[model samples]
Target: MPSEAPPTDFSVARIHETVLQMLGAGVLPPVVQAGHPVLRQAAALFDGQLNAEELGQLIHLMRSVMRRAPGVGLAAPQLGIPLQVAVLEDEFDVDPEAAAVRGREPLPFFAMLNPHVRPSGTASVAFYEGCLSVNGLQAAVARPENVEVDFTAPDGTRQQRSFSGWQARIVQHETDHLHGILYLDRAELRSLSNNAEYSARWAQPDIGRARQELGFLPG
Candidate 1:
């Protein structure tokens, strides 16, 4: 007789239950909101203050929290860490047409530490953007479509690369967090909408209509 198959379904359900228990118990650090002082202060560079092992553990925790939030990106300050670190990944599955319109593509998970970005070109695009820190609000903000960034990895390796489209936006957004800049600072105030309203009215990626109807600045 063949050996019995492993109880895969039971294991999976047990893991899910464990996760819910952890969440309810607040085992995860709370994501700091917009008004938190850490979100408004420039984060310090890693500079080897923490040992490599410690830094690795912190990065792992940050990545886990980001995934649990179901967000594409997270910055250290967003978690009140006050270190120049961030992690981002995109599934690019929200809406194919919307993703294409925004030039978003699936990106594997990556971490950036002490990153700096430079615009690759003068051209910029405006889109409705939301932030985990800001919570529930979205607005139109213009940002360069291309950028080159230099950053240190968790392993202390320096790397430089260019990104375009939604990837560039993600890099820029997370980098800004290191400098204590929130998306709302760059957003058109009149374009602000609650997440519910944005889903109901502005979910289609219409920059022109958003500007006209929502009083967003022209891209």
Candidate 2:
């Protein structure tokens, strides 16, 4: 018998569609959680100037796929590229569609080029967070309820903004990816999802508002 060829990995487009189909079909494949080598590797920085043309393309692509999948957020790593950038729900409390609906207004999409965060005050403890990489699994990660974050805008203009609640969580989460750290590595894995002998699923410094009360936190 001829040797069987290894199954071809799904294309990003196919994976994007599959995620969408699952959403429409009401069956989401457990996202490949941490432990995958891709998730562990540190992502490279975006040195190329993401001009209006490139930024627009990336934003459009991310938004399109994100809607099809109906996720609260999606990172570059999930798409198989190790770029230090991501797009997420800046306003976690609002309906996910709102980001699209609000257009470039109050709830416009966030395109972070190079992000760095600094905390100014004590962070509130909350729980309930999930990762696109870790499908079907969720955890409680403590994050600063509020903080000052400085990052480069898609326009290449430097900007500093203070965000709290769900917004803060999204920024922090994506930044961690740039350093090869997963939410699970930064969340309080031991406290929230503890089982007798097994290792915890979350990391430390978990203080985002993805806690149970948000009611919009993704799984």
For residues 4-66, write the lDDT of model 1, one tens digit per residue: 222112233343343344344546676889877777777777676566765676667778888
The residue-level lDDT of candidate 1 at 112 comes to 89
- Supply the global lDDT for candidate 1: 0.79
lDDT of each: 0.79, 0.57
Q: Which stretches of candidate 2 lie over 4 Å from their true place?
A: 1-33, 49-52, 90-107, 190-219
lDDT of 2 by residue, 1-219 (tens): 122222224444554454344445533233345666545666555565244665566556666666566665666656555555678653345444433322212335777766788776985545556666765555566677777877777777888998766667777777776556777665554434433211232232332332333333344
TM-score of each: 0.86, 0.63
Task: Please list the Cα RMSD from the true structure of every candidate, rounded to 1 decimal place.
Answer: 13.3, 11.6
The CA lDDT at 102 in model 2 is: 27
**Looking at candidate 1, what is the lDDT of residue 193?**
92
